[model samples]
Target: MTTTAPAPAEAPASRVMAVPPAPAADAAAYFAARLAFHTDVADVHAALAAGAGDFAVVDSRSTGAWDQGRVPGAVHLPTAQIPRLARQFLDPAVPVVVYCWGPGCDGATRAALALARLGYRVKEMLGGIEYWIREGYAVETADGTRQLPPDPLTAPVGTDDCGC
Candidate 1:
């Protein structure tokens, strides 16, 4: 009797799964290139209060917004007027910190770029006036404004020399 081996079992077909490629390194490089300095609202307040050498704060929001409220001692230039008013408020050699409405706004970015182009050292306040008020920092109002004694959550511990 012929002993023929049974036909080999058929193998299931294999599939080639498609996967999305990761973003190129150059993409991240490009983004990093555009990014400049960033600082939190509290640090900015402390720096201003501490009298950081020759540093100035510039508000990049509109006049109406500026009138509503702003960081104490911040000069309002507005993003549109940065080219003309930058030199008036900011010295090219000194550092200027720019801020707009809030963290989600980019108005400060444009103002910072304008200042940097004009040869001024500049940085953006990460959280702007919104965070400043939220963090319990003193904000000057048109009518009148006053700051209560610094709270533990808002200001650092120790005496005024704490160097927050």
Candidate 2:
């Protein structure tokens, strides 16, 4: 009766599998594919100053707002009416830049989307008209608006940076 008790069953080997964490989605990539282009107010002004190709600049604000003041050569096409008038005023092949009241407004985005839906190459101008004014660019007004004389702080005299 000296038989030793059977050795305790060996515990199953613990499996240490290394599972990698899931990759995060790229926010820019996801949105970039959906949007046509992105341009800041300064870029748009530069493009205009450089005499870039016949791109259309559309002010997406209402008539009253546009009447108050707007980009010198911008065409008025309110966001609400873009779906109906986009193809009529915009060329499908030409690049179009859309802007609203200012950075706080999303009207430009809405207008851009509407133009894009109609097959127009469109970009929403970041900062909108407010930036345009703050940057010292000329704007058209009912009383014959004038561009603020170039100032050294704003831009060097006799330079294109004044956006005259």
**Candidate 2 structure quality by residue, lDDT tens digits, 76-140:** 89999998888788778888999999879889988988888888888888778877776667889
Q: Which residue pairs clash within candidate 1?
A: none
Candidate 1 on 34-99: residue-level lDDT in tens?
Answer: 455877787777777878866788999998999888898988898888888777777777788899
> Candidate 1 lDDT (Cα, whole model)?
0.79
Winner by TM-score:
2
TM-scores for every predicted model: 0.67, 0.68
In Å, residue 40's CA in model 1 sits off its true spot by 0.9
